[model samples]
Target: MRENKSAVLNRFFSRNTFRDIIDSTDDEIYKSVILRYVKNPENKKNVELISEIYTELKKNYRNEYYYKNTLLNKLLLGVHSINTTVALTEIPISKSKADFVLINGKAIAYEIKTELDNLDRLENQINDYYKAFDHVSVITCKENLALLENKLEIINKPIGIYVLQNNGSLSIIQKPLKYSDSLDKNIIFKILRKSEYESIIMQVYGELPQVTQFKYYSECLNLFLKVDLDKVYELFIAQLKKRTKVEKELYQNVPYELKFLTYFMDLKEADYSRLNSFLYNQFGGM
Candidate 1:
């Protein structure tokens, strides 16, 4: 127990230790962990049957990545697959942002709160999401489930709640109810880049304002404000669908541990390939 694989894993991933590994100019701990994993991946991950070991280390930072990887795994296994384009991550709404916002026919925002995260800003985050999306879910670990439930009751928002199970899957505690908000068209338009707005306007109205860069924003805003809210929403969803058709091949070669980071977080192809090679190299015999 003193120097076993799990003990090393727990310590290596602890908040302070991880910080030291990151902050150090040249930390041997980082190299040793990676080398050990490359040589024998299974030994470090003994928590599958050792529930208490996992429970004690649940609050670690790396587990934040692990939890999301689990959630992505859950999404892949369930009705949601890699087929539909996951439009955005860290989607800015009112003030805060959604962790993952999947858009195809419908927009569903997922807000992740790892065990290490505080719920202090959750209310405000939920409120911001409501302004843009109809369906919003707060994904947290089992430890925070009750606190989220109580907070949900007080806020009275039809936000969904999901708990990360010990088996590395998500379970819905409260199903989210979608409520259509009379969203400001200006706000909706703000979500789009200048060229996206321009493209939509050209397609819909067959015209773009003949103005200088300085005057272009005001002109675009005027034009967007005149467009009906429903039309704007429809066009937004369509643009999202068109813009976000992900290359399935990239995900085809993705590592299970980095699934969320690769797909959901939009890791650069080069970086993903590097990570995939580093991790999967061992799988095939490094």
Candidate 2:
């Protein structure tokens, strides 16, 4: 019997491609592969592999979603759908990266700390992020939520706090703090939507836009299927508080289209310029 060299190469390339897509910084590429694997029943094995890879990678890294979910799961459940590793950004407080930044159309800063850490230092970190970015959020475990809440109330900042639980779940408990009087309920609702949240994260952080519209919705559904709505709601509240400032004016009350967009693409605002240039060039600069 002849050796199936081509078959071997095909399998190797398939697995490698899948790994590369998951590890890729390009959100579009990542989204496309993720969607394809998710939608096709035949690709279930690959999807499971990707999930396993995510879990294994996080295990190797101490700063995994496991740590984050443990502190916040009680308050925020929707986090299960988010790729925590990719969503979090470490930026400098004093020439250091903020612990975690949610970049959609704009940048939102967060400073994560444990209960054992110095409270004063954490406060200082929050101040630093506020100075650099328009909005700032503080994330802590359940043990510190009450203390942080009281402290924030005393300081009059009354910032929102994120509580990570031991089971990789999140609970977002608000402090009734208001940064500005102008609050839009629709934006808040949109933020609460899992699809919208994923879309925003993909756009700002993932930097990829190839996932199809159907796949985005499917992913959102899958996330919800595996998690609880209350948990998701809590996380949304936490995320909303963290990313409160809307730098640009949004004429649309809600991003209804975002739900469909989630299926096949991962888009970001920063890429608009590149997309525009590409289109312009393709259309002879018309």
Best by lDDT: 1
Model 2 TM? 0.36
Candidate with top TM-score is 1
Q: At residue 259, what lDDT does model 1 achieve? A: 53
lDDT of each: 0.64, 0.42
Model 2 residue runs over 4 Å out of place are: 1-65, 68-88, 175-286
Task: Estimate the TM-score for candidate 1.
Answer: 0.74
Cα deviation at 203, candidate 2, in Å, is 22
Clashing pairs in 1: none
Number of clashes found in candidate 2: 51
